[model samples]
Target: MNIPTRSAIFLSLLFHRTVLSLQPPAPRAIVVGAGPVGIAASLVLASRHGYDVTLLESSPETSIQTKYDPTKAFLYNVNARGQTLTKMFPNLHDKLVKRSVESKGFADATITVVPADPNLPIPKSSKLEKSFEMRNNENNEAGNAMPKSEKAVGVGYWIPRHEMVGLMVECIDEHNEKGEGGKISFYTGKECTSVSPRDVGGVFVEVYQADLVVGADGMNSKVRECLSHPRSAVGGWSLDCPKPNYFKLKKWRSPASFLRIKVLQLPPQFEIPDAEGNPPLITNSENIYAIRSIYKGPRNYLSLGLLPMKNNTAVRATNIVTRPDHEVWKLKDGNAIQTWFEKAFPRMNFNGMISNEEWDRFARAEGTRFPHCQYSRGMAVWDENGDSGVALVGDAIHAFPPDIGQGVNAGLMDVVCLDRALSGLDTVTGKEAKSAKENDKPSLGKNLARYQKQHSPEIASLIRLARFGAPYQYRQPHRADRILRTLWTLNVAMRLILNKITFNLVPPTCIILSQRPELTFRQVMRKADLTTLFLKVVVFGLIGLRFRPRLEILSMLKP
Candidate 1:
């Protein structure tokens, strides 16, 4: 028999008979952590696939019951990639947007490339103008072709992390209310101590026992450690992976990821009219301004961040300081439980720009910190026999610097890929009774390995993109070399290039499209366009970087 024919026959025979007798009668899953990724995973497994899921959370019950704060927002830009996944899951996008601030297009902002010099006043204009002009031209073309109504194609939503969490919680509740085939039970304030895999079968996890476990947990994941070390007596695995020394030779990889912010002093209502005659609108109580100034002095313009640093931690928190004057006071209680703003601004003088009342009100409204402010990229995955049933999505897999605004978008794409993979299996198995029987055999190891292999490369690329983008977008003059300093005004161009490269490189599975069956092909083309645009921008940006002169303007600007 021919090889193809023989393979087909083998497949048919395998489908007819169960490949492994170790299959469980009913598949039950436990997801650790109640963060966005964990919640998303639970919803997909339970709501879509009808799998029984139990989510374990370490927080206390009271905390879960409280309303979300807008101040502690996770600024998200749901790119086409992530949106595609959201489309797959019903009502997720709408709910997320409703509670979050949406950005229709890139915000008008500037980045100063020169190192901050305290002795010198911050420059009024840098290379930002040229960057803006270039971006404007691109926007004009894209805008003309896009419909007026749809022109608001979401770059993404600036949403509070807690808000997203609340929405996920609501969705889970709704699913349970609908009398769905599967159910989700959330255990709050309960922590998982350890997990041990059974020699005969499934893993046995010991949590608070008061609560159950479902999906993988966050940073402090007990299940993950257990799975990584099946032979360990104590449940927790050694941080090191159990593999050949050759595997140890594998290089550590960093992906492109960052959090970018456009900061401007709240211009006075009267002075809001700029040279362009465009008046800054008051969306809320605080006045908005469109000023682009570069920080040049002893202090650095931007700081690199990973996890939220504690008060004593050396890693400085970006955007705002740790302590501010304003505090939140509830009407019923004379005592104030929550403080509005934490840190004071030491460098930029607000002196006359802000009124005491305005500051107070601003403090009352925003509570000190900015909302929708963090971003990251990359997801975590592990390899086992070229397949990885265990994989991470969203913040769990890859957390990036918030500069590029791709954190949530990247995570959402992860969902899309994962869902698609799972759905494909479901579709194939459902079509034939023999196939369904065969599918009943679960290879946890194989699936986890596949998840890791498929996701790692993409995650690595994103991390690199983010790292490159963060310095440019934030214009951390301290980190810039001599060449970048000379052309400080051209920093925006650098950002545009970085944006293009990262976006273009993003995989197609990440972009969201209208679910209309007929439009599927068009969606694919749109993804291609996004990718092409990114590549072109990246190539041009690099060229621009190389050709831009370092001496001409520096001589003129020297005081």
Candidate 2:
């Protein structure tokens, strides 16, 4: 093929410009937060829908982390549910999988059980010692072997929060360079001080006005606060009481807010001595190691969960969790903290793993309190004219502990659900006519309302699930309580196995069967309730049957 002449190229450019000039202006959206959810939202809104998206972040450009940041180094396991969003863009999904450390359930994990109270006598007759021995024997026999059937379930790729955000930004930049979709303008150091419904139509984010506003700025969201508590925003004055144009979001905070977590930076390729001759540290970054301990007779306990970092250069980030009244919180100085660590984890070499600077940093860190799992009642709001719209996604609407590791996954699913609503997929079936014609622009108010209706119940269910379906681990202190929890878990597991073995009459536990793509959060909760009911019925029926013979004998003897 020959190259086109300059005149021909100029004419072609002129014709394209003329066509573009005749088209209607694109809708605009303002997304608050440059984090993973916000960036993904910007990509979808701009690319899928014809919207000029503006992404705003409070932090400066230079301040945004590109690597392992100790202060904000939280490990996120992007589960299969969350992967649905990334799969929307094949390139983005590939990039994420390439950078993340893949985990195939506990088959790749290690559990190191160290006694918190070293002085306490753990005889062979004790359950604790027996458990240790059993675990050791299993390790010796199987060598990190998991049941073949359980391999595919609960598969997630791990990535640091900031790194994942960085990858998202990079993808958006590449997409913008290609000029493939609608335009996106990203602004840094832009903090959203307030949000208000526009007088004519649309919403306002500080000085910038847009047709829609998305609040993904996290748990303490200004947009959520302003919209939900308008009276407080107006300084105790209520101007639009009778005909309030905005929707009010009411939230219920769960009671599980007592847990707290602190990040401890440790050296890579470190090993702890085990009874099986100090097995080399699994350097593939696939296995998670939990350094756990039992309750130290009347004293509080601190547990360490080590999330794998990339084997080579990245430092390991160990999450230490405890209650506010735990003994670890009372340590005043760095030396005290270091000594405490040495005493608490005698197996692991804390002195060699943590540097003096890291110890000082750990000592100064106040640690993050696990926020109560809360969900908003009304997540979407629009003006009376049905032109302006606002929606809450991610932590802004539902904030909870990371016990379930659904923080990022649930947030991403929220975006996907919103996308489905906007596309009219929720209402219209294949080849079925939509409520609006093909040429008609999507209704912001109607779609947002649809999203609210579809997503609210799921959010409520997720919050409830996070509150109760969470595993105890060491959240419970007493030995008897731990034993009860273990028995209950085993009972549930056995019931599920029996169900599978039979015709599947009994429902599975929400905690174990949550990651199945087919089951939504609401379905998970319902199944868990069903399983509990089934168990209760079985127990009481057995009890009545066992006492029936005794009752009959006593009746015959007595008048």
Candidate 3:
């Protein structure tokens, strides 16, 4: 007789167990905040890792309560890194696409660089490439032309935060209905007071005690603080240990429509071809450049962000400061927001055309009420060396500026890395010998440290790149560097450099190979020789091109 299939055996075992026993034990996890990072983390742990997760949100409702919320104003571009993580969770990407616009081209449509001086006799540069673009406008056609191919820079999807949240919640609900081994319970209108570790080496979080705690609380994290290190306790790891700074002081506003303005110079390296099909020559050495402000139009708007660098005083002037009782400025109500924009920006001949009503609709649709800013600028990971089973992921650990739209993506990467580490340890400990022993393998401590050590350098590098990535026309020195930096910033050039540097410097694959040296001779040869040869070729090409104009000429020669 043939043995039963794995699924059939599993189903038979499940049916034979008592109805109550069929349900998995509640593997408690308390998530502090219900924001994107928190929700995403909770879902991953609960759905993928078979952990019982509960998400806590301070708000009474799952949806955005405020009308003129600044958080809702902008759309998130889910890049390749983020999509890779979402793919781990079934149907997440499809759900997100249903609610948002996906694009693979740049929003600006054309790349143009301006000169440092308005009177300087410099030609403007415009180069068209396949760039990603997305808008929060509901009326927007799904796929619009932007003078380039969709596959030029890889796939990118644009979805509003609210819509993204809804999709995640739906996934959680669907998984729960199937009575899967794990579940994600949502708690609204609850605040976490503290987290403390039990004697048995599990985390205990205090909310309203009667409530379930699957600690996914956010940055002012009570769960992280209480469980890792209680305030009153003296010996164990303390949560009060300084949290990592992940953001800087920056504020952004939404414009009712795309504004067209003339500036002296273009933000660095953003060169555009002139009407004569020639690269616009750069003259001014300073970094100050200009661009025609392209505002989001009609009932939709583009966001205006303010990020202040250390010692950058000019950022203060551009901060969105509104009076307490301005006639047009009501902080939370969307209907009243347009009036504020009209009064504050007042459409003049120099300013682009945008109406108050249009601004209000866009603000309401995008959920733009509160001001958006980051207090820290990078990711933080804390590991308690002893018995305390504690770890952090997502924004709590690696927060970056939204300029590159990698916030969600980075967080997803953290989840994948952490999950893999946990799985690896389980396999080694013989915990995977049977199904019952799998979930019983408690606490990921050393594995977490390893994960942090492995991921931090790359995360830090991304933070640095984002910090210096975009060329700012407002700064004099940056404007000058833009031209020299342009090629490096482009998607094609950046990928080449990133591959070379990450592969050579980090050698993640090499590290993995060294750990698992049981490969075939041919396989080892490919990894050791072929990979190195490929990298050498790329490095040589990059270095050789610096002294020669052949590649540039070839590119220009292409139709």
lDDT of 2 by residue, 1-559 (tens): 9999999999999999999999988899999987888888898898898789999999887246555677788878898988988999888999888888876654343444443444432222222324434543633522222222232375688888877888888888888898877888989899999887755667889999998899999988887777765333432212322112233334444333656678888766666544444343433344455564543542466566666555456787877766576787787688988988787666556777678888888988888888877777667776665566788888888888876778999999888887777776572121222555578656677777777766888998998788766445444444554555566556555656756876668765566667676678898899888877877898899999999999999999997
Order of the predicted models by lDDT, top scorer first: 2, 3, 1
- lDDT accuracy of residue 355 in candidate 2: 83
Instruction: Pull out the clashing pairs in model 2.
Output: none
> TM-score of predicted model 2?
0.81
Worst 10 residues of 1 by lDDT: 334-343
Candidate 1's residue-wise lDDT over 1-559, tens digit each?
6456888989988876774555543355567677777777788878776667767777787255334332443334455546666665677878866655444443322333211222333223323344344433633422112111112244545554665677778888888898775788777876766654333334445632211133345433455444443344442222232322211112222221122231112322222212223332222211111222232232422221111111121211123221122122221221121121111122233444444544443334433321222211212223222222233456544554555556666666666556544554321122212233554544444334334445455555555444433333333333233245324323333433444566735523211222122233234345545655765887899887876665557767899
Give TM-scores for every candidate, taking all chains together and pairing residue i with residue i. 0.54, 0.81, 0.52
Q: Candidate 3: list runs displaced more than 4 Å.
A: 1-24, 65-71, 105-153, 208-388, 425-443, 471-559
For model 3, residues 390-411, the per-residue Cα lDDT tens digits are 4556665443334345567666
**Candidate 3 structure lDDT:** 0.44
Q: What is the Å distance of residue 496 in model 3 from its true position?
A: 9.3
Query: How many residue pairs of model 3 clash at the backbone?
Result: 64
Better of 2 and 3 by lDDT: 2
Backbone collision count in every prediction?
A: 63, 0, 64
lDDT score for residue 559 of model 2: 75
